[model samples]
Target: MKKPLSNAIKKIILDNIEFSTSHGFPNIVRSESFILKLMWILCLLLSSGYCAYCLTKSFQDYFSYETDTLLRFKRVSQIEFPTITICNKFATDLSRSNEVTELAKSGYIKLKSEFTDLTKFNEFFKRVDYYFKYNSIEYKDRFNFVGFDIDKMLLNCNFNFKECNSSNFKLFFSSTYGLCYQFNADKTNIRKISSPGKKAGLSLELFIGYPSKDYDLYKSYGAHLFIHNSSTIPSSEFEGISLSTGHETDVILSKTYFQKLPKPFSDCAQDSNSSEYIHSDLYRETIKLFGQYDQKSCINLCYHKYIFDECGCYYPDLNINKNLTRICDSDIGFECYSNHSASYRESKICIECIEKCPEECESIKYSLQISHANYPTPFYADFLMTYDALINNGSRNFISYSNVKESTLAVNIYFDDICYSIVEEKPSETIEQLVADIGGFLGLCIGVSILSVVEIFDSILRVILLFFSKRMN
Candidate 1:
């Protein structure tokens, strides 16, 4: 039959192999003596097998997607100033806590003793629990109405020697520390500091005032301070730095930038939109409650959602719509807050929240070095007394000149260095690197390359075409 097709194809392949540029294949095809031929054949088989093993290992390493962290230094002429948030340790103003006393007087709730000043927050809660059962008071708004006033707390503010006032600050409510005042919170026109060091940054004289002895439950004295990015919602409860009265506190900060590889290289989320990681239910319900989506805010939202679903009530401190969500009271406290504490500790929803909230592809954080000194020497206290009196409007509660040291604290916040550190993640092996590694192994083991592979494919194509042509003839 016109030379069997299979034999013709095999002969063609053999002819191409004999002249091929590939190292071991041509040596095997050209050998004449039986011993020499066997040697070349063995050599070809070993080289080919080693080459295959190297390439398989190379592919496996690349697919593993290991990453390396790089530490870099950057110097900038100007850096955006961090948001500063201050919360008085004692949340409520004793003078303005008329709501509870008024409710007690209205026969809305029974009190064991006169509802004068809240000695403990539990006393306030215990008093309110009865009234809350009968009334739907907007608890969120209540904090705004009765919480500490910024005008009373901030005695003086100076930024780069420019005068700043309560008007420069925005008010936000903190569950742990009542009303908080935040500076540089407006994102439209962010403040930037071109100079480093204490004098070039922000200076403030704060009056924490006399902490009410009645409500000594928290026992945390003075004001709570936070430094963070402007876009982030301040979580003062966990991140706050304590500022004690009678001390001048200096906070020197260094900025750090983090960048991570996305997708196959890492699990970091690259999107700026918080919705990328935030649950749909949380995004829809609590987007208004928080400014940006981050691990902290996401966790808070997730916690609120779980509490609302499981207990039919939200945390007492959280802001919620009275019409839609019930605020947890003493009655709900046992079943939801206390009894479910362990359940919350072991809940799958909480674990899932952590899984959903991944590290951002790019973010910034500040590292702080804090130092303190006894503030307002006797002479300085005397001089400030006049200014303090003027701002206090001659009220009896105006920080007394004699006790100014006990009520007043000074804060200096500034960048210690103009240069910051950058921490970035890079893939250990890129695609080009992986390819080059495979090429190196191929060349060393069997003298193969891109051209060698192409030559083999070309030979197969030639065989297929010639076989078809002969059949047609």
Candidate 2:
């Protein structure tokens, strides 16, 4: 029985082997056509080489780094017109002789040492009353003085005053109480303290700040001053007062950002003839995204609005209405200003409002150099000889009234040394494109589709399985 079974299995296996050998491979290979075989070998080599080359090229293109042009910086010239505010530090009772005397008599000699001779100072004492009156400092009372509004001062400054010549700028002035004074000069005459030579006549030390606030903002600031001789000033006053300006020690403006890019990309970034060249549509869109409010102005206004909403009144320093309906009473105003000022600054609305302010593309920062000289006023030159004649003729006010000397400010602004570069993400080829390239290369070289390769493999596997099954039976 075992011999018969074994013989039957061997016969089935032999038949299966014969069938597979005869049918599995195409008849073309059995015919041994040399040209076809050579073609097949060449196709295999070419297809593999071409596919490898395509894949390598696709990978390089996908991973390679390239400069992005769309988001680059443009090298365009721009003119910046800065807002100017002139703040006078002539306020505080310490500036007045009476106040200094009271402090000195109280045994505060340390404070007394800081005090300068009030009689020698013309601008601080003489201008204090006028500044106070102009700023409406008396609105509160003798005891409680509301903070001075530097913004309002800038708004109300008489640009047409006897001196200013720069038509490209706007000017603002603060009252005597606008800033506190720390006397650095002793009892020395004005000429000894100022800048030397003919370039000096009246010098002004200008401190610049932005988003003008109270005393806290004025600390740790930047300052710039200018010296005016007879040539620079329109007025005849040979002596100028040294004044402190701005909300801080340093002149502050909106923060600026510079976009740096490669030279080729920057060259063609914008068209000068286009209306939106300097301020592009993209910038406008960004502005709209932030709710259409100018960043700094919006924040300041929001703070003011918050104060009004909470206290049912506006701060005295603000330009808001001072009527019974809107203005806080002196007591309430001081309390609210003192208590809620900090809270309002830290509030969410304030933070959001400031955060939404658009960034400036460019800005200028400047400092002042001051000097003094003894230049005869053009108007007073003829009057020098006539003073004796006037005295002989009995003119009492002529000697007492000294001619007012004005100062000239010269500002030179230019770009800084820092370079900025703009960058963007590089785009890459998709995986689908890479696959297609590889497939096309294989097809063109081998005359074989993906389906053809799969079919060939399937036929070989089936032949092997059939032989094995026959052997087992």
Candidate 3:
């Protein structure tokens, strides 16, 4: 009732004002009032137009907020996604240095670290489900596993990659006589599945090369692995990657991938100005498997016998003679391990297991590249190749996965979200990281405009009142 009365009063005032301008006091000719009224109307119109323009611009900006693609993770109750396996548990220490061990123990999982300087290493991965340890030599032949290129292994999808293949487990190399091996070092024992508590299991770690935060789902899942040890590692040099290990269990990092630590911690986490690749060796594995690192010294053929120094071999406990290059000559396919050095390297805690396998030597220099294109994604993943073993569903685990590619790769990711999407990167000299910046900015403007307070009508009313009062001579 009050609203109608108010409106009626306002209408009457408007009509009276209009009539006064056109004819009231015409004899006296109140031209000043007429001119002032006209001016007020024009000012109101201009204000309304300007306000509308500003509002539209602002709205376009709100929805267009720039989201920096950052790495993250999520968890669910069900197992899904294809092409994965979990072999071991890992500790997420998050530091980089000589402090490979000395991480906080979380349940059955122990932190593993390097016996020497840490570089390019990690102790857990998302590929295969990893227990807290590596498979024992006693149960080496328990599983039947195989690796293949994307072409043969990719069951579905339609991405066109340059090359894809199925792994040949029986033969180690492409050629039969090469490297004196029946199967590639990795696939030697890969097909059998075992219950978690029943047998020794696979060990995995993650080493990422690029930023993974560009994807939304990955950012939701926190690392399942984390460790904090205080004994073997001095607090100053805690060498934990995304995951770490302790003395009791293996801390493993994978060479298949890499990641950038978020902000403040990233700078403090670096051993030096440079960033090193992460690997899957727990502390103990580092001393032994670290021999496989593709260093300039290890690349050539070994003609001589086992000369630790000649081959550029170095371990924390062993003082190898650098003069004995003949000991590492690649031509003879020979390498030697001093029984004494091996003893010193093995700790008393694992003395029994260490002694059982005295001789540790292998002669091979090879690199692996994993690629596939079934569910056609962009060409961005072409160079991305790092594998992991991680928990798939609540009840299952996968031992080998080639990084978080199509988490939507025919496998159900459990969430009703975009399996994948990219955010714009801030401008840089390299255009690779500069996609869709303009689009993102526009979206932000749109969203902000919807909630804007300075509206066209409000501005127009103010402008009209200002001019009318000024002209009331």
Name the candidate that leads on TM-score: 1
Instruction: For each candidate in the order shown, give its overall lDDT on alpha carbons.
Output: 0.73, 0.37, 0.25
Greater-lDDT candidate between 1 and 3 = 1
- The model with the greatest lDDT is 1
Clashing pairs in 1: 119-214, 119-215
Rate residue 328 of model 1 by lDDT: 65
Clashes of 1: 2
* lDDT tens readout by residue for model 2, 1-473: 56765666555444443333322223334337888766656655666687678768877875553333334543333322222333333232221235433432342333234337756454333232332333343333321233322321121112112232223232222222343211111213221212222222211222122222221212222222222211111111112223332121222122133332323323222322223533444334333433232223334555656787788776543222334346555455646755787787677977764554333322222333333334335454335326534643422112321221121112222122222233443334456766777667656654445765665565556556655766788
Q: Write the per-residue lDDT of candidate 1 for residues 118-142, one digit (tens) a residue.
A: 5766656544543333232445466
Native-to-model Cα distance after best TM-score fit, residue 180 in candidate 1, in Å:
1.5
Higher-lDDT candidate among 1 and 2? 1
Task: State the lDDT of candidate 3 residue by residue for 1-473, as single tens digits.
Answer: 55664555565444434433222222123346767657655654565565556555545544344334343333323211111221111112112222221221222132232213244222122101112112111112221121122222222221111121233212221110111111113323322221211022222222211222321112222112212111111111111222211111232211111232322212212221111322222212323322322221211111111224333442211111223322222222122233323443354523432332222111111111222224313342332221122221211112223333322232111112212222222212122222243333322332213212233344446556645655573
Question: What is the model-wide C-alpha lDDT for candidate 2?
Answer: 0.37
Misplaced by over 4 Å in model 2 are 1-81, 91-293, 319-325, 346-349, 352-473
